[model samples]
Target: MPSIMIADRDPNERTGIGWLVSSCAIPYEKVLSAGTMAEVFQLMESQTPDVICLELDMVGKGQWDRLKLLVDQYRPTVLVTTAEATFERAMQGIELNARDLWVKPQTPEYIRRVLTRCCQDQSYRMQMSQETTGVTGRAGEVSYLDLFFPRPLHGRTYPIMLAQLEDPKHHPELLRFFEDYPFRDKPVLLPLGDVIVGVFPDDTHEPQTLFHQTGKRLLMDWEAMSDAPLFLVMYDSKEREQSLNEKYLDAIQALHIRFFKGYRQLTIVERQVNWTMIDPFLTPSEQRLWVDMLHGGDPEVLKQWMYRHFSYKEEPYPEPGLLRIRLTSILAQVRRYMKSHGLDNGDLEQEYHRVFETILYSPILYRIVAEMLLFIQRLMDLVQNQREEVRVDVIEQAIRYMERRFTDSGLRLEDVARHVDRSPAYFSTLLTQKQGTSFRQLLTSLRVKEAQRLLLETSLSVGEIAERSGFVNANYFSKIFKEKTGTTPRLLRNQKKR
Candidate 1:
């Protein structure tokens, strides 16, 4: 008859879990409860339970080590419960070989479902062990022996390489790439969840060179089979005292650099590379420069800007997070340009947001940069078409006329309509329909933009600046500026000065 223990600080919780377990209909002959860590330890010492529902958050660090020892000793089916499911807590659960980590406030159905699955898993494992007592070996035996053992075969130090697929879903297929790879001394392939760690024999002459050569060949060949990219991190040799597990960990840590280096190639894991400090946000001056570049309508300059920032591989590289934030800042500028050109609609807007997400979440820096370039090029194409259309486009011609004469104190919708060879009311409707803003609103925006430029660049008086920005009354200009910019002209100028 199997027994289970429910360990929590609360009596009600222990009783509730016990009742839920009984309701699960599993053949648990005994249901034990422990309201404290010491009680948990005492119950374990008395007679180790087959299953333990442990509240890991209640266990102190010192008691945790002792509890882990007990767990390792008895090999109980542990279902860890915690107040918060953090990465650290999840890792601790993994160390205890926990069947699953359930966060607190779990529903009855979820707890019952988890309990049933874990109980069945325990039974299956026991059955397997009993049946396989006399069996010789099984698949992944090489992985077991190499990773678990403290030392490798004496006098033979094999090189370790860890391959991580670009897409985690394709990890299982990666094992096949190494298993059939034509190495002189075929490497022992080990599947480590989303990573495959291989230990290659150092038998051939210049084995280091040969290992690198084979890694390249495998990269090219694997891509032929699957479209997903692969990243390989290799260590030439391990320390005399280092075990294969340590080497595996080292390679895994080194694999993180792949975010900066990119995929579909081999990287020799030699030394630690630190990320240099960087300010991710663009300065006001830099923002203005980007606006000028976009207004200049040259995509090559933007392409150069992309390459200048991203293509450099000098150590130490800027942190990936910082670069991502910087990319988002640039994307904000691109978004404004899209909106200004009436491109932020339908598929173009969707593609813009897609590019935004890629900049935020894409694993590879090169991939992010490539996607950004493609988006910018697409926008540039649209801008070129807009430029050609401007020659015959009534709305475009009207907008250009407004841009030229916005500084004139007497400039109005009628003047722009006359320039574009259309009636004032008809052009006003067309402008509002195409630009998504009224004629008065659009003219105000143009004038305010000029005012901002003058305020920031020149040391002109408020009244003088208002006249230059096409406002007859300085007080009305101040009110309109405050309404449009959220600040007074003098205050904005003062902010710039400071």
Candidate 2:
């Protein structure tokens, strides 16, 4: 099927060229147009037509490299069309292997003749190329791996597919697939029994056709092999350059979505992922409750949380990318949770990586969820377990503040709360809850203890001791002292002397 794309900034010129191409004798399978270079690169991912009618005038000063890159990779029959042209630019186009240079507003007859000729020439060139390269048999087929992989060619995007078999027993046969894909389209393969990454020329290939043909080949050779359910994620790195490892990470992230859905023959980019994806299992209220529970230590609530995340469901599959996004969000929460609890994040990050890889390859969603939830639960457990220690520290600090400030008659619960930055009511509640005593009782105990210390350690008179211990006078101090210790200050001093 013949195809053509018109690249032009002017809509009128694009319309004119499209009308001419339509009226041309060759019936194009795809007649496309791009107003910018980005759109041109985007369109090339799925469809690299036999002919690309390029508008030279629209190419920005910095875009010459991008133009040269297109020529280097796809080698479409480039018809350099511009309203204004130059000898230097025309020669440049010729050097880059552009088929011809033509002025814009081309007549129907001229477009018809030139386009037909270009498509014919391209077909002839491909036939010669395949023969010259000796790619006739299955055994001798060339993979982009032979030319690319360790060293990637510049100015070309590679479409990568990561395929993981749900069953690992089929791994041995799948490993053989790593060396060479069982297809006419030689996909550069990286083999992991549970994970396989396949790469194809981004410019000249579409993911669906490539994966389909590969799947077909595998079926024909294996001879009633197990259902061999494959979970796959396909994408092209056309927008930006990325390393093979980075591409693999993208696939793994994509694989995270596999936890929500059953096996798919092919899973291309069909769904979007966002925060709402985890709503079915964990909602906003649940998130807040979990945060609260981390402090409160609700074991039953924690059990319910694990149940929802790890529970199995046959119907109502979640969206494919949601699981990965949710997992990522959970990991972030873990870090924040650790930070809030005054814990280091380094160990958690390393632990998360270990668990994350396992999560991706786990056979059941229950295991993956269990692994992640365990990590989250471990962090939450740290917070929960520290609840007592934290409470003790707060109560102890409040007691010290009371002892230091008791002599100041103006001292009040609000003053103590202000020092510790807690509301008076909250500080008071915490004191009773943690110490089994109220603020007034604790304050009085501190004053009596200080009065005893004065009687034993120094010869301070009862009146002076009363003033220092925050009581108004010796009488009031003695009265409170008897109530607390069953003795008067004068009697305590006399006993200490004895």
Candidate 3:
């Protein structure tokens, strides 16, 4: 029987996650929850759990150091639960032996799938550890001597199947599964650490069922267990060529094909000569849909919109060169959108090559698409610099409009905004930010300045000054002028004579 432990600082998360994991009924001997590192240590001393659902946020203090110590000491299958999970964090969580990391807001179903995989892995490792001594492979290579019996003395050309690992971490489980594969009686699978190879001369006595046996056996029940796709290249020695070495060469060519075209169904090197590339797929109908979004100037929303276009249904399987070309076509849409915002296409080819090269370097199809989408996002983010230039011009125009019309007593904020071709609310905010005051306050200050100038520089009476300065009446002018300069308008004119 296996055991499970849940460790987290948050009580709600500890209990909630524990309850959900237990609901899966993963055949555990014990299920314990820990709120602190002290409790985690205590439970670990009593019985080191077979599986640990660890919350990285609860690790606290030393963070990665503490987590490393726990992982090294216990050697438990650790499933990390983090509030924030990025690609880098997930990469850090991948240990050579046992660790699965997931982010929060995950459904019970996803948790169950990960937990099931962990338990199955842990159980397989424990069983294999005792049964096979030299079978534990090194990181880089595998020893063929410890793996299989010395090559059959009746050396004849045998069929070979080659598959590149989706994740090299799954090598041990895959190798172990191949050891007792219920498919063929005499087939021997050689685990090369990074690659899995199968030799079939076992059923050659049945000659007709020779090549079809391995492919047909794998198609049943294997796909459901491993959602991760592998680059599978299977070759037939009896059907195609006379030499086993030639068939092995064909397997190698097929693997290289996967590196370029991206992984899909069984690839036959013998059958796939003269395969044509996909036609240029620049769908003009969908051009406006993506262009308007880039001009709208939110890279994050544009990225999400791009993500919706991705699906596994890439029919008439595309070549690596064709896929790269498709990526460039999508990027050209962004460039077209940028041109409207004053981006020059002068060094566009150099810029396009840099991003296109980066997209091609992605190992998987979805990853290639994701990298291109992120590039488009960064491209759209550059539009903010242009937007900044436009904003300054609009604010300057609004300020000048206010200065020329301040003496008009019936001046309204709406009319000023309309003069500058902006909404009243937007113009008001820009004016307040730029001039440091509201429309009404600036208008009053301008009128008072004119009243003060007439008192000092002209022989104008208080009532006459008020009429010319855009005040409603002489009494209102006196009240406002006295409030502004702390003296009546008539008194200021008399004082100036002294």
Per-model TM-score versus the true fold: 0.44, 0.42, 0.44
lDDT of 3: 0.65
- What lDDT tens digits, residue by residue, belong to model 3 across residues 97-150? 336677886787887788777778878866654453221223212234423433
Q: Lowest-scoring 10 consecutive residues by lDDT in candidate 1?
A: 132-141
Candidate 2: tens digits of C-alpha lDDT, residues 308-381:
76564543456544564565555555566677877756887688777877655555566666677677677767
On a 0 to 1 TM-score scale, where does candidate 2 land against the true structure? 0.42
| Candidate 2: residue 481 Cα off by (Å) | 2.6
Among the numbered candidates, top lDDT falls to 1
Model 3 alpha-carbon miss at residue 451, Å? 4.5
lDDT of 1: 0.79
Query: Which is superior by lDDT, 1 or 3?
Result: 1
Give Cα distance to truth, residue 292, candidate 3, Å. Answer: 2.7
Could you tell me the TM-score of candidate 3? 0.44
Q: Measured by TM-score, how close is model 1 to the native structure? A: 0.44
Q: Alpha carbon lDDT of residue 438, candidate 1?
A: 90
